[model samples]
Target: MDAASRQDADTATPEFTLRSVLVGLAIGCLLCFTNLYFGLQTGWISMMSLQSALIGYLIGKTFTHPSFTPQENVVIQTTAVATGTLPLAAGFVGIIPALSLLSQETDGVDALKLSWLQGVEWSLAVAFFGVFLAVPLRKQVIIKEKLAFPSGTATAQLISVLHQTPLPQPDGLTRRRGYEALQSDDVAHEETRVVVEEDVPQDVEGEVVKKEGWADLLYSFGASAALTVAAYFFPVLFAIPLFGTHLAREWLWSFSPSLSYVGQGVIMGFPIALSMNVGMLVGWGILSPLAKLSGWSPGPVGDMATGARGWILWVALAVMVSDSLVSLVPVAWELVRDYTGHGKREGHEDDEEEPPERLVPLKWVAWGIGASILLGTLLVWVVFGSDGIKSWATVIGFVLGCLLSVLGVRALGETDLNPVSGLGKVSQLLFAVIQPRNVVANIVAGGVAEAGAMQAGDLMQDLKTGHLLRASPRAQFYGQLVGSAVSIVVTTVAYSLYTRVYEIPGKEFPAPTSFVWLNLARLLRDGSLPPHTGQFMLAFGLVAATLAGAKAHARATGASWARWIPSGVAFAIGFLNTPSFSISRLIGGVVELLYRRHLAKTHTPPGREIRLIIIASGFVLGEGVASIVGLVFRTCGVGAASCWGCGTGICAGCG
Candidate 1:
């Protein structure tokens, strides 16, 4: 490449134009739909982003050289990754539409019915609104203070890997000799010595620069396949035995002397499934046993298990809202600094590089916010009411949602309030104050809160990536719009299919419900806590563990602590997942370790590509396959009888 081209490649702005954003959105939507369809068919939420990223990388490599500008590279890579992953997102989207159709025939379809069009519309509007809301807050959270939004950190690391270039060096020249020459008094002598040193610089050509290879592909494929198979044959077994072993252990231990064998069996069988086992031991085993002894079978706790009352639901909503509110403080501060004159500092030109001019001014943020509220109101009107009263209530709810979201952004700092549990608590508190009559409203409210939070969090991460690559803010904003829209469609579809095939008589499909609704219900009704709180505490307890893990990740693996934290969260969550999932993750972890230790041999290539493939493919296949199997079993008239052998079986007999 010529010098001008090279300079352009190096210094060119990362321009994610309206066109690129639209393309990304289109790709993201397509992937989401495909993933949703497959997820419903098979029960796997496919890894759309993973596939997109890998494909994008390959395409970029094939068409361009490593010397390509980072901006161009990101555009090509993101496009490819988005395309590859679109199917998964599509699959998720398809789930809701599928379920909505199925709910017409199913009895007690209250929980099952979700209007796909409404969901999409609201998701788009709110997601768009979230981007505007997030922009003002970015500088505070990301730049000013650098509160560790670890996911953003990981994205930055990934970008660095994708953009990094190596320069050739001359043959060996020791630093000792160079230092001695530098110490010489004569300037001419030093200049000559420097030239000589440059002429005989150290040779680094033989030194390995790690790159992704066939092994990564094999590992990703194998791991995804294994996880899919495990989720297929034994869901419940996958659920409690592997994922929620703590609950299972507690149940078994409840029988004490009578079921000692069962408890022993579990411990001996799945040692890695510790979090759930511990949780169950504490919640069901120890707590229940003690409750019985004290004659304190709290009506509230029982009610929570059987069905959440309206008051309980409200409380959950309150908790979720309140917590989210609490978390937005830092984020809001960041926004003021970025857009307005509030936080400007003298001689800070280095920090405030001129943000490119935009068609939509800061005033447009208010317009977007208004549009979001209007759209949300329309959705509520369609879902809950056609009458004027329902219309008014829906409007009120929409306004409330927007206000809550804004307040949440202002108070909480950034949106990643643990949606299942944390936001549920906020909703619960609000319900208590409002005295809402229907439990479903509280549930819906909480879902909205979570969706908002999730969208906000995602927007922040995307912006962070854009900032690092010097991509235009508008491009990042649009890309998110595309991604969220597509992802929602996929999620909806997958959810729909899974529910249809695996509708557990009285229960909703557990996965979505578990993370989203049931856990919230648990918190609101019983004031119960999630396992993450314990894990967070445990992180503090094990300083050595943190240091060791972080160091190993950074030094040995060439990954930052930011990556480790999320991975650790995934691992902890995995421990709470089905045994099959834990087993799959364990296998994946082992493979990763081996690759790092034996194969890579201290020259590790970026694992993001491999991980993206495995995680995306595994999630998609697992969910998709499981759904298909459920449909087949349902068609065959093999109800609860089929699930008897292993608790993971799909039999609805117990209910």
Candidate 2:
């Protein structure tokens, strides 16, 4: 390519046309809705983005020639993948409003359900605001500082591998003659240079020629389906058994003496699920048991359970708040130091580091934010404001919602922290502070605030990804708007239909919304507390264990003590994961070690070896898919029947 052509290619904004945006939105929405459907059916959060990224990579490689540079290919693949997966994120955002509608319908009271149009409006607004907020922050986090977003790094690495492989040259007499001549030469040398280079390896050339074909596609799809099935039906089988047993024991003991063992056994089967289960066990099981033992039982444990739940809710909220505050302090301090003369010498010329080209200008961000806010406000006014009391209260609620969102962003640096629980607590407290009638308003406001926070976080991630890919800021902002709109509409419709068709008569689907209620109940009963106590305790324990392990290793092995400590911890943690997952990881690690050992015997290209690792990642993805599918079937009451004699329930046939 000419220099001008190269310049244009380098500088030109990849066109994110409306059509492209819609295509991306559609794909994302489809994947998201599918995942959501399965999630609701099985209670597993499938990683949709991984699927999208994989598919994007395949498509990019298929369409683009091997001659394309790694960077260029990455740009194409990432954009495709990100766009394809946008709907899932958008759908999640829409779920809040949909749930709100369901609440209102069931309760015959005012709830915070935004109409389809309103949801879209709010999504657009959030997208716009997020773009602007993220752009300023990007310089600090990504470019200048280079905080590692591991996912992005992995994506970049994959692209590099795809680009580095050389396609086979067509065979001809000239090529044969040249090769023969070069091979025949006693000392092959480049003109004017006597520099010696290592011979190119065959394995390196093989990777370029080994294009992903039908087998890969079929394997990915089958693996995904199988993994999802396994995950859904046999979560316990995949879980760390010992932890599950402990949780079961602790929780069951609170309910009934007879069930304690069973509960313990359950805990023994699933470890990672321990944190939440143990929290519940302590709060409900142990506390209730203690309360009963003390003759202080005021009501049924379930009824009185609100107090413990509330306590935990407050602690969780506080932890999130405090963690955000602590993290931000250093970041903010650095920002100030950078801007002021404290860090760099005063009046020193600003280094000529290349100014990052603007992706989305400030003006477009303002427009998006304004539009989102206006639409969100309008939605609250209509759906929530049908009653005069509700309408007035909702107006105030909307303001509070916006305020809380801003605070959440500032406090958390991202809106992923669910504000609903905190909001619920606040509402419950308000019920005590204000009249009971106003409780509805508080709940509405809290839900909206939570939704806003979540959407904001999503927007930030999307913007960050876009910035990295060098996508036009305007296109990203607009794409988000379109993506969110599609997601809200599709998700709402899907949720409504699913709820109607698959509504379990008495059993409520454990939506994230329930956590809001749990939090609110907790707040009303007790109050807030520290959230990070458990994490802190865990950290302390880890440190102590590390030191102890090091000391023991030094005494026993006479080897470097510190080296053993990390490995010891890793081994223990690996054992803590579900046996299936842990085993798979262990096997992969073993294979990698073996490969490296063999490579040492015969000098092979490092790049070729790395490709094997990438391919192995597909196994992890397969496991995840299996888990999801298993959960879906189990939730739908299909159990092992859906897996065609793959045993019953979660662990019917498991050893």
Candidate 3:
């Protein structure tokens, strides 16, 4: 090749260095613990791509030997995102916990007991299939269609901005000179000053408030972590009696002071927080009392089979599933319209062939997908037993999972929302007809589909980032492989460790999403709805569907009142957990509203919103980390009973 041709080839194919892959793997494994902590605490999983990218850049800066290019950082980020998704993909937060809850309800008739090796094998079997599934679609979905994957595009922008200037000097000379210039009056007044003043917010007295982003982050993190640890020792801190102890225990009315829930609320914002509290009041205040008065739920408050918790679980699941399915109509309509050639396109499809070197070999994808399917089937058969899920059913589930992944990716690309849970519900409904009365089969089958959707959506986003950076798809794919392998081990171990220490469905880790899955499995297994459940479910489902439709209409019409409409999904989630969680979220939501509506009325700070996010993220990370640390203490023979709030009469229950 000529010199110009060689330059083009070099630019097209950047080498994936061993150091970058290792860095990515290491970052990814650590985030696996953090993500699982968030996922189980709430249903949300924080994306770590931006965080990973910045961390990787810092690592490269600290280590002067091996240079880390933007392309290599892309690899690191891709690996981290892939591994961060493993907790959900491996069924740790949702399906596995749901299974455990099922076992608890059934008195261990059908318990899911997997050894460490089996856990790793099960995770690997379900996780990698989605990576291979996204390989062939890169050219079509990412390059040609050019669908805007918003998260991926945002990560790319951040990377580009980070690399705009050359790296700073290693010694203090260049940095000192720059800092000195910023402090000078003449330099500050210059129109084109090196430091951007727009980012610094002014206080009430018109004086510049020096940025304390790191300080704020550390303070919030420390406070949340300390609260979590302290709550462990003084269990009374976990619950505040809203009414008397009788009402607190019997009616389940108490305020849970949890920093983690407040942190989650800050990110979720006021509307969702409001909706969740509304749902909580309806479920706990209205429904629970009515059920008990009418004797529909005759058992104690905590009884899963015949109590208020179990009864409301079905209603919440119905509402959530209905809302998700109804919300999908617009996206599905656009897809159908486009496919039929009735919808508008950016332009006619280009028939020009893409460069051969840029494409992932079709043969490789085909082989990988085939292998994943076979392995998944074999593992399902071996682990779940032939009596649980038949071989044909397992194969069918995998096939359906792969198909649903297409829809999942499309939804993610267009709307920045992956309806994995909805897709899993669809899978569950399908199995309800095909293989009814098998609780294990129902849950496992849904898990298979959910895992595929989660992994596929995550990988596609990473690939979109890679595409934007002009990074080699092949290299990123390799990084994804390494990340997936590492996550399969790390996430499984983390899940096992947490489950051993904390009760899955208990206060510390409610696993709300797991309850949804568990209730649905129970419905399918017995084919007999609980007393008053069918009626209540139908009522909640209709309400959820209506609200979803109205929200969509309001958005289409640009109605100003749209923000007032509560999210059906968020409202339903309120019924899945205790009232205390919603109360804490409400507190955070009120604070967020006050800040946005009242504070910074003159001119909002550029990085003010980011500072709030940092605070929220810190709170979540601190609580999660504290939980893991607390697990270590327990393992080292710390008394679990000391953590119980039994001595405090305010909580009503004693050990």
Candidate 4:
């Protein structure tokens, strides 16, 4: 809060410190474990943006020197979010199971078996493609076009609020000026320098104590971690049910509370919650049950509903691709026009401020991608390999990946929907045409695009968060780059541990995305689908996808009524995963809505919303910790069947 501290705050020296990297890596490991567990459990991956900033703010306060800036916390979060999201985004869990399944199915496929080591390398390599794509495109898409990445924007707001410690510079009012600059949403550093040569203004209450901010963060962290640890051990050791269940399930049978799912609902708000409920209701309750009654469904009600969701999936993919085409035509035409001098070329705005310093140069990024590709090609050749076709496959696959990466980011910015799984099909179709018999080629080529597009889109989103915070792109790039390297080891361990403990694609963990990808690969190879697939109904899906895509395009372009179009991704995923999870989300949405109404009706106090949200976020994080501890004991061979007992579960009775 002093002048010397303010000067330190204004500089960027501490952004890449040892403490930042280590802490970021540690948090990234925890999130990597959490995301890996949940992706397989629910066919969805959790993000670490807000959670990282919130926790980083705590460390910045009680842990770090008073001069720690907002940008430094951002550096911490960039790495954490990168490590957490990239595995799922880059197709680690989804593709790995498919590879494992294929290795078992084919006679010589065991030669192509993906070890955990290969999994990490492949993830990192594909992510390299994403980085190359995002780095250059950040200016074009985020700055010039100004896409609406809501989550990223929200994170920027969070950073602004939480990192308002010890203001910068007495004479200049630097902290206040810097914040006002950030409000532009397309801000540059020059816009932020409003100097006032005077002593720093004091609050009405006099010499302001900043310890309250740290206290709030610390208490919230402690309470959340405590609840999480308690909930975790009790269920395993004492057989005391902690995971909360829903409406009628508790009356009829056993269940556990998933606080995390509910928290997701709270974050996503009503539209997502409503969509999930409707998807479950229509797909699981009515249609799937009816199909079962008529002998048209398979397995359980959830499994049977997946058959209908199969119908939805293809339609969604078709619609998504078509929507991409609709937007692409105009952009393509404009580019052509500009190149041909058929239209006036727009110049950069003279009023705009200079961009912040970049850490990784463009040349370095380009070369890094090219080199990583070559190394990746060699590794792939050495592993499940090729007839001199790996490099060719990688090059072609990466080209298409760049296109899909652009499209995916644009679509996500517009509608928060990116058909990441769909990106794999571009590779599938390309390989199918080039050499239909090359199964390894198909998986590798398609996997490249899948990983590249997903990562690129993820990077673009993160950059948007950075852009809003006026954080340096280079600093974030370095953070993520190191994080990706660290993840190669940690994620591999987590994936191996989970696979060993619980069989994926099994009764407990369905791994629905894995099944989808594997079946697609099968369809590409033999033009056949497993029994209960309803492959005959794909035509219906195609038509539905086209119509839905048209509707979405309309919605994006300002046809508010078109918002009624059911999201293909959400609909299919909601139905395919357990109905109870969706139900929990719906409950969270209801709670959030009611709380909002209460605030409006009674006019709540200043910190009320913040307090409630902190508690809720605490529960969400606590659930993640609970999951980690449970996994730890399970990985260590603790639990039923491991211990010889009157009851195999972890009770101490009857020893």
Candidate 5:
């Protein structure tokens, strides 16, 4: 073939096709709604990239003529995950609800109300700046520093595993010869290098091994979805009375038959699950009883003040804050050292970086960042009012957001935990001083930080996925842009719908994260906490620090028992919610242990390596989608009470 024809053949396959974008939008819209529903209920938004990529792959394979390529799957997942995170990005699960609670406390005098139009505009304004912030850092973080970004890395590995077939070469060209031909150009050379040297799972001379798990995945998905649908109607099925009906109802100690919870535990694995169960036992079984007996918290079970739930929240927040801050010490030190010329070396002189032409242009990204900052400030002034938040505070908040997002990215890259909440608290503290005694200003400023950290970390993670797949960074950026636009509408509408249907911070929809934000803002404003909560907070903070230190040391020393070390973060999560959630998670952990110790040896199913992940993902996805569907059902005047749930009284402790 001639030179032009050869080059055209090399680049024939498209990564950013119309079908990819359309399919991605559809998936993203579903995930956006699902995440909002799930996040409000559990205070956790499960990662959606792997699920999206796998589902997108399945859909393409089943429906599309040519089938979806690995690069296209990367785009689909990148868009979908970014879009799914919108609820958090839009502050629906955290700041917005927190602000609403605060307004209620102040008798509607300080409410920062927004119409649907304003909500869409506000979310749009704050979201894009973070995407812009992530662009320039892609090379430094993903390529040069080679930060793990575990979720991103895992997604990339899955994609590679899914598309392990030998690349289609020219009519008679050998595999090596085809690679050599692509190596003539700089961009193609970089792609060829990574593919041949790092990513390709098979040898040049080896036969391609096709991996198939569609039948198993589909079966599990259908089963999980059906269960989810059934549980919505019955509700009592998931609230299993494992510890007698009284303790299950009053102390929230039931074993949940929730596929979603178990699925989460499977992904989290045994160590974290054990920690969460331990936390649930200690916080609910031990501490909660003690608190009630001692009269520290003597109100009803669900009361945010003078109740077991309220008391434990402080303890959980203390653990989470201390653990997150202590964990950041090592990362912070490295970042400081890097700036001071003593950083740990990551790459060698021989390493080849992607060509400039393939990167998101720095000049345009910088302009976009600046533009987004102005837009954010303008929106804050308009929505919150100039009196509520000064123009200067908004600018400072965004700057602080950008700075903290770097830390957020570092944590996410190293440990797969974006400490957005902890980082937001930092912003809240700063704003407490900057806009003293102003609760509205405090929460809004913190919103900027949380949104920035979340969006920046999310985009960076997506970029890392693209990097591994040899997908164009520019295409991924565009995909993110489009997905973000969809998120604004989806998240706002979902939040609006839910608020109309149910009272937030109520029994059914206890938004845990919002309470954290609300309590902190209240403490800053009122200069006090409930009862003897201060003592408990101090004690738990120390324990959290100790556990965090121990975990870090265990990992550093490569201890044999390191894997058994309880994660402080998981412990905090356990403390944050009801025991039913944690108990269900432990069930999944037990299953994981069984699978590891016995099932793997006994069962050699097709796609044995990824079977667990597929099944677990199905459970999570099925429940999330079903929850959204249920929400719609409730909104359409089909009250949940009409079902065989708490209203019909099949079981005692439905809540």
Candidate 6:
């Protein structure tokens, strides 16, 4: 290729097209609606990146004149996934359960529903912090430090293969060979240097390779639909749950295996599943019984009985927040001193070190951050009764949330884990102490921190994908901005409709995440902090604080001890919720590990690996689709209310 051709090939691909935006929005809206619906039902969030990529690739084939580029397809997938995982939907998913539980005066259905105006305003107030907060860290974390964003790497590789984009050859190497050189011994020599024949990427006789995109997608979709039907119908039809088990058999002690849990294992891997189980065991086996023996009554905290779970949550939050803040201790001085630019290091010159180009300009991002914070400030003040104490506390929470957002992004960029609830609890704990009497005020403040951290972490993932794909960062920023805006409106209407249609926080939806925040806020706000064990919490907090320090120390020194120690937040969350979730996740991880072992031994056919992933993703998507369909039926009053869940009743928990 000529220099100009190579330069053009290396430039950002065709992007910001109207058709691309429309397709993305269409795909994103479906995913946004379904993800919220599914999350409310299953407590899992499925990202649509890979799914969107495959669909976009197939759909792009129809626009033959321009021909769809891999880069453009990325825009479609990015926008869809970004929209699907918006902060407000997540916030509502978690918080609404607690809100529902809070308003249960006499087990009345739909007794208290937060207005669409209230829900949207609360989510809008601070959700924007995530998008802008992530922009600044790309240069420092993704490029300069080169954090391992595994998901981004996978997406980039997938795009490269799908597009057949040329992999660059080292300069001056070529497939050119003369017959004369091949016939002579002197052919190996180029003046004093021996010439080595370079391996070329392609050959003139190469056969045309075709992909079975349509066949594979159709087959996968069919299988997914079939599975969804079986999963949905078998339980209600036979009075047996196929997805998972909560029933106790006379001979069995542990709970049932969950397919969704196993699917999560496939996505999240073994370590996380194992760690989560550790927390469950500690909570259910060790702590719950112990707390019960200590004269504590079983009270409701979300879906789980309030036992040692409450204490575990408080201590875990304390540990995790400390660990999150302390992890940045080394960079703290540099950030405060010369954050305008990275400080000096050996062989690093300020003049030579070029920062990665940004999609959205730093100034615009900064302005957006300030504006978001300001918007959140006004919303919090107004929502919390226009009180001076609450408004000012909100401002302080938002500023702290912004600082924590950096940490949250860093945490996710490094660990593929964001301590979102932990950050919120930090705000909750702080605000709870400061304004002990004001539970609602405390929750609003914590919600800002949680929303900021969660969204920032999510956006960081998109930024990582854009970086790897050589995409326009600016385009991605706009896509996400647009997507989030659309998600807000769509999620608002969908969630509002759901409340009217279903009795939430009932047997159908546990809303585990919201349970923690809502219960904690209510407990603190109502002066009903349970178990009557302040001294134990104090001692546990001290120990947890020590562990948090140890984690920081281990990271600094590259100690092996770090791996042995549990994730404070995960374990704490596990302890606070039911053992079922943690145990099921562990089982899922084990299943995944076994499946991987089989794959390693079998050497599956080309694209089978990708197909297998699609199957897993499709399982998630299938269930989500089923849930949405069932929800629509329930809304239309065609759903069954039978004891055995017959007729139009798709899921047993449906209202």
lDDT assessment of candidate 6: 0.56
Q: Please give, for residues 1-655, the per-residue lDDT of candidate 1 as tens digits.
A: 7644643554455556444444444445544544444332222332233233333343444444443444543443344233324322221222233233322122123444545565555444344545556766566454554443323333333444444522211111121111100100100000001111223222221111123423443454455445434434433433334324343333221111111112112211222223224433333333444443444443332222322121122222232233233334344564567569776644434343334462235676788767776776676556545421244444444455444444343332222222223333465456534434334444445444544543454455445544555555555555555555555555455444454556521222332222324344334444545322334333322532453245333533445332233222222232222223234433433333443354235543323323322233333333433444555665576554334434432222232
List, residue by residue over 1-655, the lDDT tens digit for candidate 4: 6645543444545566677777777777777877776677666665666667666766666677674577777778888877876657555566666566555354135534457777666666665667667787777666665666545655565565555432222111122111111111100000011111123332210111143444544464466556555544443322222332232222111223456666656655555567667756755555454555566544443331244434333333333344334434444455456459785335533311224354457788779778877776666666555652466777777777877777667665554445565556666777877756556677667777877777776667678777666567787888878887787777777777767777665544566676566555556777754344344235435644665556556854878655445544455555556566677777766776677678657855333444434445555666655666767876786654332322322222211
Report lDDT per candidate.
0.37, 0.37, 0.70, 0.57, 0.71, 0.56
Q: Pull out the clashing pairs in model 6.
A: 262-588, 359-473, 359-474
TM-score: model 1 vs. ground truth: 0.58
Best by lDDT: 5
For model 2, what is the C-alpha lDDT against the true structure?
A: 0.37
Tell me the spans in candidate 3 whose CA falls farther than 4 Å from its real position.
1-15, 54-69, 101-109, 162-214, 242-244, 344-359, 555-564, 597-600, 640-645, 648-655
Instruction: Report residue 211 deviation for candidate 3 (angstroms).
Output: 7.6
**If scored against the real structure, what TM-score would every candidate get?**
0.58, 0.56, 0.84, 0.78, 0.88, 0.77
Instruction: Indicate the TM-score of model 4.
Output: 0.78
lDDT of 2 by residue, 490-526 (tens): 5555554444434321122323223334334334434
Model 3 Cα lDDT, one tens digit per residue, 173-234: 12110000000000000000011132232131111112354466678879999997877666
Off by over 4 Å in 5: 1-12, 103-113, 165-212, 344-352, 556-561, 599-606, 640-655
Q: Number of backbone collisions per candidate, in order?
A: 116, 35, 0, 5, 0, 3
TM-score sort, best first: 5, 3, 4, 6, 1, 2
lDDT of 6 at 491: 77
Judged by TM-score relative to the true structure, which candidate is superior, 5 or 6?
5
